[model samples]
Each structure stands twice: as structure tokens, then as C-alpha cells.
Target chain A: MKKDEVPQDDANVLEGKLKTLKYATNEDGSYVQVQTVGWEPENLALSQAWEDIHERLEIIAQDIAAGKSSPILYFMEKCLMEPPMLAKHMGIGTWRVKRHFKAKGFAKLSQKRLEKYAYVFEVPVEHLTQFDPTRTS
Target chain B: MTNKFNHRQSAHCENGVVSNLLYHEGIDLSEPMIFGIGSGLFFSYIPFVKLNGNPGTSFRIYPGYIYKRATNRLGIKTKMRTFRNAEKAMDALDANLEKGIPTGVQTSVYYLPYLPSQYRFHFNAHNIVIYGKDGEEYLVSDPVMDDVTRIKRSDLMRARYAKGVLAPSGKMYYPINVAKDFDLKPAIIRGIQHTAKDMLTIPVPMFGIKGIYKLAKDVRKWPEKVGERKAGLHLGNLVRMQEEIGTGGGGFRFIYAAFLKEAAVIMDMPELNEIADGFTKVGDRWREFAIMASKIFKQRTNVQGDYQLAADIIVDCADQEKVLFTKLRNLKFPA
Candidate 1:
């Protein structure tokens, strides 16, 4: 907070349209009120990580479209889980989970199996099974 | 009935909301003051509770504790309610807004349109104030934002009903009444004492000072037990918990230090200033741990991170906090 000690009336004005914190300052470059404690470093890093997560999601969506990977991968990433974690949650083996990650294997999933995944992901069964990967929302 | 409420940006959500509401009530209090009086600080590491496949590690008390405790200390009688149905919750908020009462509501952070997409997650327990409505959009005063932002009813509803751990459940709260006086000395004393006991006296090893030590020990084993990639994820998550999200860094140690500094001035307890400085150093140590972990996360190092060394750093933090809280617990405040 030594930054706060710079005798000022306001924090510097933020530049970007993004809602991240910025300092407000006077025209003469005097100190003013702080918009927030700057999170530039941490948030910058988080943004990169989030981009990576979304990148995986986009690839999974492509796989689903190409009938390669199943929509299960999409739900898994949405729920912030990996195969091993979901396998543990579903009381199944990781190999089974990995198999289910394929479109052909997922299409043959039992109602009971699909229901278990829906339960763990906290999504409706229909939403899980009939989801449109292209739908951004 | 909508009043033009002053919107001030703050470091954290709940504390900002509390400060804004109090200011509207004609009581100007700093965010740290509200936090300290409300006893907003706490620690709990529940390995059984999982968030994104990692053990749930929280630096502060559950959401709404600060608003509840801080308001009560100020003799403010507030009404808070949660609903099973989203319609009723929206109806109640509309009613309060119609009555010119800016109400506080909890929502998930993911759906707030004003925030950067990267920062948005499924995490619930974000607090904001609804000050007005224009046709379909509600005027929102999200504390972390630089100005008042507008959100459509549908988006806001989705935010309120967001599912997952610690779901908001369409919860809203507002102060129904405010008293003329609140005796601060006792509240400050009580809050400090409560924090001390929780940090030092709690028998559970996964909470307070013990929790810090336990995390230090458990974290070292993550690489062995979960593999390098997943272990790396856990460490990164720990950093997020400490630095990103709602924490103002070092799990809010610096914020608490600022609180102590203000408390010292208000109560004429200059010694509290010394303790506050110590806490700042503690926060710095936390930052140090974070910097070290960041290197591991970025895979910048040639060899695997020295988990033992990192664990030692946290143990040192815990040790410093233990001694500091002990002194704070034993300190006699003037009656």
C-alpha cells in the first residue's frame, strides 16, 4: 500500500474498456483516489489461463462436430473436471471415462451412465446429452 | 423511488457493498473498518470440500458474514432472506427498490457482463447493490467496478440462480433500520479476540494457524500424490485463492493490517500500529510464496520446484501469525 501513500486526491483513470482496476489522477499528475488495488499481474495471468481453458473447450467442440470426441469433454471442462476426477465421481474406472470421451462410445452410453454424469456436472440430463457445442452461451 | 447512490470502487465485493450502504445511511466508514468490525477475516481449509477438483481453501469467513457482523456492530437491523424460487427473490428485490431501499444481493460472478471474460468463473457469493431499474435493465453498483453498470433482467436472474457450490439461491439483504449510536471499542476488542481464538485455539488442524501449517505439509505431497500436472494445478489454485479473486493479496492480511492501523488511530492505541506493520510484513511473506509458486506454474525453472522450500515459507508465515495473534489476544484494551 506504499502506493496509496502518494499524496493524492484520486487514482489514475483507467484506459481500457475492460472493467479492471486503474488509478485516477489529476491533470497535473498529482495523486488522487484509487480505483482499486491493481490486479494487473494476477489477472493478466488468470486471463491467460482462462484463455487456455477456453481453447481446450473450443477444440473439444470441434472434435464433437467432427464426430471425434464426445460432448462429454465439453461438459467435463465446463464442470472443471478431468477424466480421472469424473471417473472417481461416477464410481467408474478412468479407462471407461476415457472411452466415454469418444463420440461413438458416448452415443452408446446407458441412461444410467448419462444420468450419473449429469448429476456430477449439475446439469440436466437432456442438456448433457443433447447439448449443442456451438452454442456459446 | 430510486436514489442516486454514490458508487465507489473497492478492492473486494462484500466490503465495498457494506461501505456503500453505510455511506448511504450517512455513516462514512472505511472498507477496512467495516471488515474489522464485521470480523470478516478467517481461514478454513476443507480438503473434503472440493472446488474445481481441488480442496476448498478459504481465506475469509463465508460470504455475508462481514455485512452481517459489521451492520450488527453498528446497531443496524437488517433483513436478509433466501428463496427456493427465483421469481419471488426478484419480486422482493423489486419491492425494496421501489421503496427507495438499495438492496444487497448475492450472485455468481460468471454472469456479470461488465467483468472481463477471463476473470469470470462459476464461483458464487459475489455481492452487489441494485439501485434502480429502467424498463428491462437493473442499475447495479458492483463494488469492484469503477462506475455503476447496467444489466438486463434476464442476465441478472441467471446470475442470481447460478448453480454449484455456495449457490446464492436468490438471496438478498437490506438494512431495515439504523440506530443513532454504535459503541466501537467493544466490537473491535471482540473481533480481535474472536480472530485470535479461531487462529490459535481451534483444535482442528485444518483451520486457523494450524491450517496454514497443515497446508504447508499437504502441499508438498501434491506432486507425489496427484502427479506433476495436477499438483501444479493445485499450487496455481492456491495462488488464485491468495492473490486473485476477492482477496486483496496475502489472503487479506494487508487489508486487516490497514484495519488495525485505522483502529489504532480511532482507539488511541498506538501499539496496534506496530502490530499492523507486522501484519504487513506477513502479507509480504505471502506475496513471496506466491512469486515462488508463480515461477513453478509458468514452468520457468529448469528443475521441479523445491516443494519443501515452498512449504517452509508457509510454515514461517504461520509462525509469524501465531505470535502476532497471541500478542493481540493478550493485549488489554482500555475499558
Candidate 2:
């Protein structure tokens, strides 16, 4: 892209503070580094990704409210982890992790296991057990 | 904290880190030059490997390879280590900092608190340079950031040990020695030659120019195979991979073009200037594909026809890249 033509669309993804470098051609036809705040397509893609994440979180919240699943499921989604990956981090069986997704299974959890979940999610023990989905994360 | 340790931001993190670190050692190399010498331009589409529930489409070589390859090609001795214990890793990094050695660290973006909130995700391969430690905070020069930032020691540890795919596991590396007066001609030629070989001669269908074609085919089938929403998410992923912050625009195409331009002048081959321009045009084609894909993803246009158009643009990129790499493969560098 020509240096003059580099897009500075003021993409909100950068939050108007961060600027990223882009390589563009100068008037002399030589490439020079140019700083861009944002680009339209990139911002769109970023928002779309976050939208998907929020939608997934919303579904998990509903499941938690319905007592079909526990707050562990909500926190798991918040951490952007799948069951297998979270289990690997926890150093436990994937089946055990899946079982904890249930409200009944979570309530029967030992204090040690709850602490593990809280630590993995970077939340406090109380937050893990007393999660209120109505509160914005 | 280190005397005159200047941090220069570049388009991609690894290239920026490599270039900035070399410059600190009195070896001045541009980001594109390091990128070219490292053979960083690459394409890969792994269907079975999912990132954020979308099929993985990577525009460059895997993390850490660029620094490894570029330094090796330049005959620069370096040391790299990954630790099983976080305390040991921090201690090693602290020791290196005390010696005034700027270390390249691989960390996940999610744990980097300085980044814009929107930019933070579970990406585990983001590269940064920690030049000094001030009290409990580490001074960081993240390549994609416009300015230097500081991270607390605890946060830095979390970032370095971020879990999930491509976990960094506290990886740190730095050049231990640099030979005086090494020639760039041989490194440049070898770099170009290796990239040509990788792009044109790779046998795997999921890699090289073939990967572009494979992605094109998949794009055409995404709407039918998956539902519209899922397909749109997939296309959004393609856009994100291509135009995202670290790519230096056009998924590293512009950077590659700049490399070709520099090589043309250094090698005294005037024809490479034209090829650089050709590659720039190819980069624009990639951008066009991104625009069309985004439109379809947003449903701003007719989804069916636009998918075909998007696929055609990708196919065009594949064809152009095939021709360009072939030309590069056949080029005779003066001995």
C-alpha cells in the first residue's frame, strides 16, 4: 500500500491509544514503516470473534441458571478452554472434569478440588462456587 | 535500564524482536531483512487443528523458528531454553537481565495486561523482549506495540506459562555471540532459495502454495458443509489471520515484498524490483479476498456468489504465488 493510502480508520480495537506498524510504499516507491491505528476489516473480524465468545458465555450462563450445569461451566467458558485442555492443565482425567460441569457434581466437590478450579481460572474460591452470572464478568 | 538499548517496533513480534536485539549488538538489520533471512513467509491450513473452534489458517512459520533460522543462517550463535519450573525460568531470565542481555520471551497475549482489551486472547505465541527488571516489574518491548510497556513480575510469569495450544512454558532465547563482518549476500541468497523451495516444493497438501488452494476449496464448501453462521465465523477467522495486527498487513505479503526490494538492490538484480512490485500486487489480491470474505461474513452481499468470488481471489493468490516462487526458484544468483 502507498504510504498515503494506509488506512487509519480509527479502529476501536486499538482503543485509540495503541498504534500498529504497517509497511507501505513511499512517494519514492521505497517501502517505509507506517503506523496505523486500525483497519476496518480487521476490527470487524475481532468484534465477530468476541461476539461468538459472548454468545457462548451467555448459553453457559443459562445452563448454570437452569441447574443443568454448574458455575464451573461458566468459568470454563470465560477462560476460553475446552474440557480436554482444562483437564490437561488441572492434571486430571477429562471424564472427571466433564463430571464437574454438572451442578450436582460440583456441589459434591472437595475443598481442594474447588481451590484448584479457582486457581486455574484465576478466580477466588468463593467466586468459583458462588458465581453470579447476572454480574458482568 | 541497559545503556542505549533502543526498542524499535515492527510489524511482527518475532521479526521485531530479532531485529531489535541484533541492533542492540551493533548489527543493524531491518525487520523485513530478518524476516526474509529467516524464511518466515509461509502458508498452512490444518483442518483438524482448531483455534477458537475455527479451522487453523496460519500465514507464517510457527513461533520461534524465524529467530532460530535467521540467526543460524547468519552464523550467529544463540542459546534457547524452556523450563518445566516457573521459578527456575524467572531466575534464569533475571540472571540474563543482570548481565544486560535482552532476552526474547514467548508469551500468551491473554495474560499481557498492557495490550488493548480487545486484542487480548488465548494466543500463546506472541513474542516480546524483556530488557530490564525494575523493582517488581519487567520492562517489556513488545514488537507490535507502538511504545515500550512494563509488566509486573507476577503477570509476566502468568503470560510465559499460559496454557493451551503452543504453550510457551517460559521459553527464553538470546544471541550469545555474533561473528564480525559476516557477509549478507550468502545469507540473503540462501534465505530466498529456502523460501522458494518451501513454497513451491512442499509435498503436503496442507502446506505451501497448495494450502492456499486447499483453503480456496474449503471456502467454497463452508456454507454448504457448515451452517451459514459457522461458515461466516470461519471466514472471519481467515480475515483475522490475514489482516490482524502482527501480520504487517496483507498477511506478511507486504513484508515479503519489502524483503524482495531490499534483496534486489543488495544482489544488484534489477529484475527483483519488478518481482517485488508483483508481490505487492499479490498482497493487494489477498486484501481483496479479505474484503469480499468480510462482506459475505456480514451478509452485506449475496453469500453464494461472493463465496465463489472469494475462492477465486484465493486461487488467484495461489497461482500468482506459484508463479512468483517458480521465478524465484529459477533465478541465478551471481556466485
Candidate 3:
């Protein structure tokens, strides 16, 4: 791509706060580094991916509200994590992590266990326990 | 006990880290040179591996291979360590800084507070250099950033220990010995040859130029094999990996082209210059593919025929790369 041809498409996800570096061909056919705000195709791909994540999270949030699931699922989806991944982060068995996804199993958790989960999620234990579904996306 | 580290930005992280560290040691090598000599250019599409519920795609070699291979070919000795205990890892890093060593640390992008919120994800294997320390903060030289930045000790710790796939686990490395004088000709040849062989001769359909063809075939089947939304998500993931951050566009193809240009001058091979231009065209095709795939991903077009069109573009890319790498593999080098 030519230096002048580097895409400067407005990526609202970047919020106009940052510019990324790119390599473009100069007149001599040699490469020079150029800063780009964003490219249209890349921005579209990114938004679509994020949209998929949000859609999944919205479904999980509804489940939590209906008492079919726990807040753990909500936070897990928010963080782009699966049960196996969350289990690895929490240093627990995979089956145990799955159990925690349910409301009944989550209610029986001890304080120490809750603290461990909170630490991995980087949230306070109280926030996990008293999460408001409407406040989150 | 801080080392006199000079920070310079580059198009990619590992390449930037390798080039900056070598420059700090009084051996100046541009990021393109480091990337080329390191055999960093690669491609792989693993359908079995899932990321974000989509098949994984990689545009470069495995993490840390660039540093390992590039330095090895240059005959530089380096020390690397990874720790299971976070406290011990932090202590080891502090000790290295105490000895005036600017250490390369692998971290998770998600925990780096200096980055924009949108860029923060569960991505591990991001590399940065720590040159000095203040009371509770450490000076960071992230190759992707335009300027040097700082991170709190606590934040750095979290980044190092962030869990999930390819977790850093507090990995740190630094060059211990670099030869005062060395020749670049042989290393450049070895790097080029290594890349050609890998791209052309890899037997697996999921790797090398073959991987591109496989992905092209898969792209056509995606909407049929899976539903539209899932297939679109898969294509979106492919675009994310292709135009990955810090690659300077067209995956890593542009950097490889720059490397070839530099190598042509140093090795006095005019033929290599022509080859470099060909590869640049291939890179352009890759970008073209991204553009089409992104449209399909966003469902911007009403026609379902877009899938076959996108697949054709990918096939064109694969065919171009096949010709380039075959010519590259057959090229002769001066002893």
C-alpha cells in the first residue's frame, strides 16, 4: 500500500483517541512507517466480533435474571472466558467450575471460594454476590 | 542500576523487542532485519483449536521463536526463565534490573492498564522490556507503543500472571553475550531459505501455503457447514488475525518485503529486489481478501455469492505465495 493510500477510516471503537502504526510503500517502492487511525475492514470485523460477544452476554444475563444461571456466567461471558479457561485461571477442576455456573451451586459457596473467584474476575466479592443485571450490558 | 536502554518503536512486538535489545547492546539491526533473519513469517489455520468459539488462525510463527531463532543465527547467547511462583518471578525480575539488565518480559495484554479498553483482551504472549524501576512503578518499552510508558508494580505482576492459553507465567529473557563483530550475509541467506522451505514444503494441509488453500476451501463451506452467524464470526476472527495489531498491515507480509529489500542491498542481489515486489503484491491481495471477508462478516452485502468471491481471493493469494516461495526456495546464495 502507498503511504498516501494507508486507510484512515474512522473506527469509532478507537474513539479517535489512538493511532496505530503501519508500513506503506514510498515512491521509491521502499517501505516507510505510517500511523493510521484505523482501517474500515478491520474496524468492521472488530465490531462484529464484539457484537457476537455482547449477544452471548445478553442471553446469559437474561438467564441469570430468570434464576436459571448465576452471576458467574455473566462475568465469565463478559471476560470472554469459557468454563475450562476460567477453571484454569481459578486453579480449580473443570467440573467444579461448571457447577459454579448454576445458581444453586453458586449459593452454597464458602467465603474463601468466593474470594478466589472474585480475585480472578478482578471484582469485589460483594459485587459478585450482589450483581445488578440491569446495570450491565 | 538501570541500564542505558534506548527505546524505539517498530511495527510488531517481538521484532521490536529483539531489534531494540540488540541496538541497546551496540549491535544495530532494524526491526525488518530482525524479523527476516528470525524466520518470523508464517501462516497456520488450525480448525481443531478454538478461540472465541472460532477456529484459530495464526499469521506468524510461534511466540518467542523470532527471538530464539534470530539470535541463534546471529550467535548471540541469551538467558530465559519462567516461574510458577509470582513472588519469585517478581524477585527474579528485580534482581535482573539490579544488575542493569533490560529484561524482556512476556505479558497478557488484558492486564496492561496503559492500553485502550478496546485493545484489552485475554491475549497472552505480548512482549515488553523493563529498563528501570521507581518506587512502585516500572518503565516499560512496549514495541507497539509510540513512546515509553510506565506501569505500577501490581499491574505488571497481574499482566505477567494472567491465565488462559499461552499464559506468560512471568517469563523473562535478556541477552547475556553478543559478539562484537559478525557478518549478516550468511544469516540473511539462512533466514530466507528457512522461510521458503517452511512455506513451500510443510506437509500438513493446515500449515504453510497449503494452509491458505485449505482456509480458502473452508471459507466457501462455512455458511453451508455452519449457520450464517457462526460462519460470519469465524470470518471475523480470520480478519482479526490477518490485520492483527502492530503488523503494519497485510499480516506480516509487508515486513517480510521490507526485509527482502534490505537483504538485497546488503547481499548485492538485484534479483531479490524483484522478488520483494512480487511478495508486496501478494500482501496487497491478502488485504483485498480481508476487505471482502469483512463485508461478508458484517453482512453488508445482500448476495450469498459473496462467500465464493471471498474464497476466490484467498485462492489467488495462495497461488501467488506458492510461486514466490518456490522461486525463493530455488535461488542460489554466494558462499
**Taking the tens digit of each residue's C-alpha lDDT, what string does model 1 give over A1-137?**
34453222212222243343322223422212343433533543454456567778888888888889987888889766667656756878889999989988999999998998887666778876787866554
**What is the per-residue lDDT of model 1 for residues B110-203, given as tens digits with 9 covering 90 to 100?**
7787776556677778999999888888999998787888999988887887665677989998887977577777878877887888888889
Q: For this target, which candidate reaches the highest lDDT against the unseen true structure?
A: 2
What lDDT would candidate 1 get against the real structure?
A: 0.76
Winner of 1 and 2 under TM-score: 2
Question: Which is the winner by DockQ between candidate 1 and candidate 2?
Answer: 2
After superposition of all CA atoms, the RMSD between model 2 and the true structure is 1.4
Chain B alone vs. reference chain B, TM-score for every model: 0.97, 0.98, 0.98
The per-model DockQ list reads: 0.17, 0.73, 0.69
**DockQ result, candidate 3:** 0.69
Better of 2 and 3 by lDDT: 2
- Lowest summed-lDDT stretch of 10 residues in model 3 chain B? B295-304
lDDT by residue (tens digit), candidate 3, B211-326: 99999999889888887888888888888888868777898899899999999999999888998888789889999999988888776443568999999999998899999999
Clashes of 1: 16
**TM-score of chain A in every predicted structure:** 0.71, 0.90, 0.90
TM per candidate: 0.82, 0.97, 0.97
lDDT of 2 at B188: 92
TM-score head-to-head 1 vs 3, winner: 3
